[model samples]
Target: MTAMSTVPWLTILGLIPLVGALFVAFVPGSAETAKRMALGFSLVTLVIGIIAATQFDVSSSAQFQLGEQHSWIPQFGVSYALGVDGIALVLILMALVLTPICLLAAWHDVPEEVGPRGGQRAKTYFALLLVLETFMVGVFAATDVFLFYVFFEAMLIPVYFLIGRFGGARRQYAAMKFLLFSLAGGLVMLVAVIALYLQGPGGTDGFLIERLTGLSIDPTTERLLFVGFFLAFAVKAPMVPFHTWLPDAATESTPATATLLVGVLDKVGTFGMIRFCLQLFPEASQWATPVVVVLAVISVIYGALLAIGQTDMMRLISYTSVSHFGFIVLGIFAFTSVGQGGSTLYMVNHGFSTAALFLFAAMLVRRHNSNSKRIGDYGGWQRVTPALAGIFLVAGLSGLALPGLSSFVSEFLVLVGSFSTQPVATVIATSGIILAALYILLMFNRVMTGPKPEELVAEGVTVDEGWRKSSGGTTVRDLTTRDKLVAAPLIAAFVVLGFLPNIALNFINPAVDKTLSYVQQAIPSLNPAGTAAEGSSK
Candidate 1:
């Protein structure tokens, strides 16, 4: 069989989870069955993602790969176009990898109905998760701007429900806030998308990314259009002022939902900044860089300070992400291939590391009877749940950029690369690292290291009657076999990516080079090659 005859793997990859969502919704089955079906389908998607990655030509030109395009709306110049570069491919793979783990992590997370029949809840929950998965894959793979916007807007629907329906107390408030914030961003982007459409040469070719990139717009128009797109991305990126919605959403949602929100959905914001803002409005990007860099630095320091102040564990983690995302944005705006490539790799690493932290924290909350998320409610947990505490430490250390963790590699590259272009910002941003250590270690100490509360011990003792009969009358238990299974992949990812980040950077660097070339073309003096020249002369 010719290579062309091979399965349309990218299309299949997007479809499997979507089709699985339908099956979960319609099939007559128990909650257990729905959970299994969702996991199975997600795993299939993960396998397909692997196959697609293997098929990718990393050494090829820095253009969209494995493309599949078909005319969708001839009148609107829109088409069903999908493709991936190294950057998109890695993010897509991260999404696929995380979905199954999320399924497994949430296997017993959904509460059963107290009254008559709790028939519909599991079906609805699993179905929405699968649907979200489909959109996640589609968003990363979409090549056409209109197609990306469609996926971008559609993904929010499932997430809204995932938070509103399956979240903690104040779920409604958090869900509404999340919805409103996202809708506002989407609406702003829609206007920009329309503006872009109107400006293009009207035809079926108008909305194609390649076509849009070649447009010659006036400077004022370019900057205005850039603002439209950048505003949406900044909100989604939840930079500083726009970031207020994330803490509440994370605090209220289930760990799995929060994981996907921060890990996958938030990546879209930074991804758009790179793919759209930088690529389409190169001069405008450079024009906006001074202000954007300042915002990024504020996000870094401000987020870290806020994280240190958070009483709730989930909110604390969410704030830390704000801080981490700042580093990613800084690397992106630094305008060096090394910086861009580092930012791309940071996206992947942050997803896995954040997933581990959120999911593990969920397990701890579960052990604590699901009510108390306050750090004060959990002290000396390490004494009772050493395994869980150890895992939490590993995850937290990754967040703090410990040596030999995935985050360290990415964070290091971001600083080193950005320093070449923006030294003052990079130096200021470095202080966030110290703040990171303080927050992570302080949280660990408060929640895991202090004396065990007598009330906590009493509760654990009351719940585990069998513990008195077994060893030493220890009340609290460690992570179960299933919990270990869910955590293993995330832990492995941290280690693997930490040591062999080249596996991702090798693919990412080519795209970074191409994007930098565009930016250099726009502002010749800002060229990274100039830095190389300076180094050679020295």
Candidate 2:
């Protein structure tokens, strides 16, 4: 075994945001100061994440890097164990990168007097966002099942408050639905966790992933345990039937909040599937692949079809995520190295792409007075807000997997890889690309092009409503300096990753190979010869 690195970078990465959240909460400051402080802390965390990435040994055979372990509950075999592989590292970086962008985008989002807190609401809002960042880091970096579960469940609180308190008109309903669905999934997972503990060697080693993976469990027990974990993950992934809560939650929350919710938090589901399901119950994972793949295909077509029908811009973006997640799940369950690697990269790419779309959409709403989320509310926006339209167009193109964008590379790899294993399903899922184009272009055409609305013309263009109340006049502005600052990085990420995916794939492929190795070990019949042959032909 490689000796654990002495520097606790992962701990520092997780703690910085947490500490910042505390400081923001108790320290007295104006909303602008609070926003600046949060952005500073998040950027510092991003630097730490990049440093950790640089330090990571990409070529190592070790499954996890940057490991740190400490005893937490000796009797129950729980420990404060933290580590990341290439896959987790990428997702953690995604979370770190998006946090500051979200803060910058939301600089003026919260009203001065919201709920009972009035002037203090901004402080509370930024604090909650930072606190959520801590859980996001912890969830991805955690090596112990117990620790992961704790971070997993703890994540909902901050998001719930973000939606219920700071969101749109139906925020309370959306928050409660999100909470209930998530809690139910957690409870199901709790049962599996306890059962796995009992099935393992007794005492303090029971909850350790290294120890549990070594246990020889019966197939029946493994399958049941897999269901418990899979159910939770599927809900979190918000796949098809279990995904009803997401559209509401995404639509109701502010775009910055929605960005984090869909872009970062939801990745936890697919992440858990890879970490827990495939790693811990390899046989069960193989057994469930057939049914899961079907559901994934359904999610692709279903989500895309629904997205095309949405009039509300926020809800439309939310539906698109459901479709994209389906691709991630499809790639994972396909059990090929390329498939899994593509899925992992897709998680990172999706975060940036979705962040751009959500944040830009929010900016559009704000420019339109933040009073109307409907696509019909604005027209010929491209004529006046060309900068906004250009970025929005790039984001939309990325969402639909335009060539030379990050999403296209990942989506292409996923389809090619999955085709080697499940050709029929892969072919069916191809139609989703067409549907994606339809929804994204259709939404873009409706909101960004055509003629300017008569309302803006008749009202004399000086907007006095919503966030634009101080703007003084009816001329809709283009992307502001701050907006470009938030947008530029996301656009750069799409371009860089699109062209040089090896930057990520070099790290991701080894971890994916390790995962597929375990799957083959559990089910020797699932050898990669078939996938290899298919790839060679291509």
Best by TM-score: 2
In terms of lDDT, the poorest run of 10 residues in model 1 is 464-473
Going through the candidates in the order shown, the clash numbers are 0, 4
Residues 1-538, candidate 1, lDDT per residue (tens digit)? 0112145777898899999998888888777888889899999999988988898886776477878878999889998888888888899999999999999898766766654456568778888999999999899888889999999999889999999998988999999998999999899889989999888887984677777884788999999999989988888887988999999998899899999999989999999999899988999999999999999999999999999999999999999999999999999999987778888999999999899989999888777754578998888888777888999999999999998999998898889889988999999999999999999999999999977655443223443211223343334557677788888999999999999988888778777776677777778988865545422231
TM-score, candidate number 1: 0.94
Model 2 quality (TM-score) = 0.95
Q: Residue 261 CA error for candidate 2 (Å)?
A: 0.6
Q: Give candidate 2 regions above 4 Å deviation.
A: 1-3, 114-118, 454-473, 530-538
lDDT by residue (1-538, candidate 2, tens digit) is 2237799989999899999998887787677787889999999999989988888998788888899888899988998888888899899999999999999888887877655555588888999999999999999998889899999999999999999999999999999999999999999999999999989886765687777774689999999999999999999998988999999999999888999999999999999999899989999998999999999999999999999999999999999999999999999999988888889999999999999999999888887854689998877888767788999999999999999999999999999889978899999999999999999999999998988654342222333221243343455556667887999999999999999998988888878877777778778888877655533332
- Displacement of residue 204 (Cα, Å) in model 2 is 1.7
